[model samples]
Target: MDCPAGVVTDNYDIVEDDELWARIGIDWSERSERSERSGDGLDNELWARIGIDWSERSERSERSERSGDGLDKVDKLDKLDSETVASPTQRSTSLPPELLRATPLYEALSGWCRHWQGSDSEVELFHFSRPVNSIDVFLNLGVFGVMWKAQWKAYEGQCGSHDWQTSRWMKLVTLFVVFNSQAAALTSLLLSAALGFAEVYVGAHVLPLNLWVFCGYMVFLVQLCFWQRIRSCFVAPWMVFLDKMCIHQTNMPLKQQGIDGLGTFVKHSEKLLVLWSRRYFTRLSLGGTASLVYSVKLL
Candidate 1:
């Protein structure tokens, strides 16, 4: 029988036409027969024909189920082991092997090793040691250096404004007398002890010598104290005051001028105090007290 228009027949004796069989090349009669045999078989056959093997698929599914069963067995074993084992509190307190070898502090410090070993910058080294120890050392040194420089500059300026010869002579005499008396008394004491003479020194002699030495040292110390006070109260304040005055003299707007004046004063004053305390007071009071106690023991 001749086929209808746009109809074609395949060797499978399937009749196809454009409207009904364009997709699979199967005719409508074959499709109906295949659909009658089993509704889902054609889809499975098509999948199989395209290199999709159902046997291999079935094997993979079975293996997956077996793996799931094995995992369930492992979970059951874990639960049993947990119940049979000792309590958590009774577990060993020993550190793990790896952790014992590489401690947390070691790890933290090790992270900075590259920075320390590689860098030539002293500033970076200073910062590197800051987390450990060098911060306090550098801070104390910086404060003292700045303060010393400031004081020396102020002293030089003051000397330039005055009679240089008179001021120089007075300073020279004060230093000489202070050092001479202290040295003389100390030498006398040492000689007396070194001579090994029993009952050699009379109270009359020792008393006046001790008094001279004590008084001389006290005077020198008082001078130093006066110098420190002058620096803090007069020199420092005057510098800050001058800076503020300079700021106010500027031709800025009123609001900006006020802010600048206040800011400059505060900044200088804060710096002065920080330098004074960290530099002078910390060294003189804290360090000296420690040294004094040490010296007394030696004496």
Candidate 2:
């Protein structure tokens, strides 16, 4: 007020004003005009040219913040959608279904539902109830020497192994009974079916027919017929990886997994019962002994 102000000082005051001041000039009259225009919520010619207006700072900032937040949320949603659209299997299996619905997996499932609804056993909806223990309270084991059959009785369940999370200290049995021919596997299968049916319907006395059961029509009861050893371990629901029933023959992926996991199976077993005979080793170098070779290598 005491001294005449310079052009820089005049411009600085206008720039720092709480309201938008009109006309960026050093003239006092123009500065007074800017003050008159302050409270109107709009600005001068320069601001108008750019389509900007003097909206309240707080309100404008609030709107900008909301827009930023919305954009961030949109980006996350888009990423989730791309993942599901690309491949549904890539979705994390760990997330609970409630949370999964907003994700792209929900979209993928919706798209999939329109085409074909698989069996209830195979697919599930929002109310995804996990499998009720398919393994019975008691194990109905059918131990066939055949490639894909079993004759199981209702043995006890593994008391502590509810989630298949057994202690490493607990070693189980893996019956390595890979014969050189399919006939051997067939005989073992027949024996399993016969013994299972008999024990349930006829009596335990008829179970002895298994001893005469030859794999490949040979005189070999190679379904690990050492009942005394096996029977001793039956007090607990012993995890017996029986030869025929252990594989998922119809499922190629499962079959390959079983084949690949043989080494691990042998390593963990407390008892690796190899149902070996002269024939197993006699044709050890031959064609059909691939199973025998894998078993031998694993051992």
Candidate 3:
């Protein structure tokens, strides 16, 4: 058989063109046997059996051939191909310790809350503990800062009622950036104020009734100011209601019942706050929760 043009062969040293295999010669008589043996593609297993390491060969090529990106591209392709073949099987084998622990709990909680419903009269019949101060949710995410800044801006004529009410710029891009920026600035201000309040609240043995009332009033006022406006709806700090903390995690009966009540808690609530992440949507339960909340909102 004739050698193809531009084809570099690994056995070229053993079969020369001009001398025609002088030092190391190939017997044409056994060509049929050799052809049959060489039928397989040059995969990693073939390279291993022949005592050749593709990884080392690729590394050497990368270091020596810097003039063109050909070798680099080939190396990257090989790496990606190998990873694609091996990745899926190994993906779940190396989960973080925290993730491994939390995944089960997340799944269980989500399953329990999947079919929860809320009726108009269902007021906290489920054993859901309301925080001592309902205003804690507002104070938690620096929402007060957001409110204060907006009010101050309104006073200073920075953001007027016209700007808030007008639908002049109905463009999505305009709303996402300009409106979001304004909302973010207000939120930052509210957060700073909330942090100050939190620090004071922590150190003081007894918080005065006036301070509590002031905080609550600020929260309520801010809620009204931004009600219909978009502030990345999930702006509030998540109210952590863990099974271990709030429900009996080890007790299956109690755990299931408490988790089921979570849907009702979300149902009656005026706002939905989701703590988001890349892994959040992957879990069946979390996706279900989001869907449930969204369906409720749609209704």
Candidate 4:
């Protein structure tokens, strides 16, 4: 994708660069020593600081770069097992492996190596291998929803529709009365469309989950990366403020506020997509219905 300068690139490594480290308040000079002992790997502390699981990083070997001093120290401690006793200088230098491992520097270095090394079948596929024109795709075809045609036609006929067209943010209200309704396909489709790819492309290339079995975790990751990149784009792409996904619906206090905020959300929105189905109206008390009514009132 030909993104204007400042937009997120397909190169995910940029996020791990010195600029990001400085922005996140890391002292690289102090931390750079860690990099030498461990080649640019992240610890749980750094991962937590950045709101990512330590395991989410690309896999690498554990404790692969023990310093010569550390190894020599360990070797001296081993000599104590011999029949011949060592000299006072050697005895003084000898320290238990556990104590060595417990030292602050050693602990920090070990922690880096012990970070989550497991992988997820889904997460691996959601990784962006390339960039596409997500903005142009969104502006041209809009998003996917059951009521997209009628709602879009009505909006286009209205006098203020032109303003809505140019506005950066669009509201995609996924409506279904059944909270437990099957949304795997919808989730996959919406996510792929948001990032300018077909669901097949997303599954096959972007983050392939074989046999159409989608993972909610992968979807969340896609949403996160999509929004993060959009925020950096010169022309901010449309944001999908999914109700149940984005808002705290189960928490009464927050749910009320989120329900009430629907008016304001739609007030600034360009497109309102209603994924209407038999399941939508049945759960009128669930807030999807209220969100649509409140949004339509603003329109």
Every model's TM-score = 0.17, 0.21, 0.23, 0.23
Residue 134 C-alpha lDDT in model 4:
15
RMSD for all candidates, in order, please.
Answer: 30.4, 22.7, 21.6, 30.9
Off by over 4 Å in 4: 1-235, 249-251, 286-291, 294-299
Instruction: List model 1 lDDT by residue over 131-201, tens digit each.
Output: 11001100111111222112100100100001111232332333234323454455556555543342355
Which candidate wins on TM-score?
Answer: 3
Angstrom error at residue 232, model 4: 8.2
Question: Model 2 lDDT vs. the true structure?
Answer: 0.32
Scanning candidate 1 in windows of ten residues, the lowest lDDT window is: 152-161
Candidate 2, superposed: residue stretches over 4 Å from native: 1-234, 282-299
Index of the highest-lDDT prediction: 3
lDDT of 3 by residue, 1-299 (tens): 55333223342222223233221244443333343455422344434644548786566445535634433454477889997783422321222222111112122123222312221222322233333211111111101111111110000111001111112222222323322345455665676577568668775446454455456446544543343233325464334233233433455665454444444333223333233334445555555544443444233
TM-score of 4: 0.23
- lDDT per residue (tens digit) for residues 269-295 in model 2: 343322322233334222222332233
Candidate 3, clashing residue pairs? 142-191, 144-190, 145-189, 145-190, 146-186, 146-190
lDDT of each: 0.30, 0.32, 0.34, 0.33
Model 3 scores a C-alpha lDDT of 0.34
lDDT of 4 by residue, 1-299 (tens): 22223322232333234555665676645455444444434445666776655454332122112332322343356676564765432332333221111111111112221211221122221111112211111111122252222121111111110111211222111211111123434565665465545445555566544633445447644443243233335554333333322234245554444344333333333444433233333442423343333334321
Clashes of each: 1, 15, 6, 6
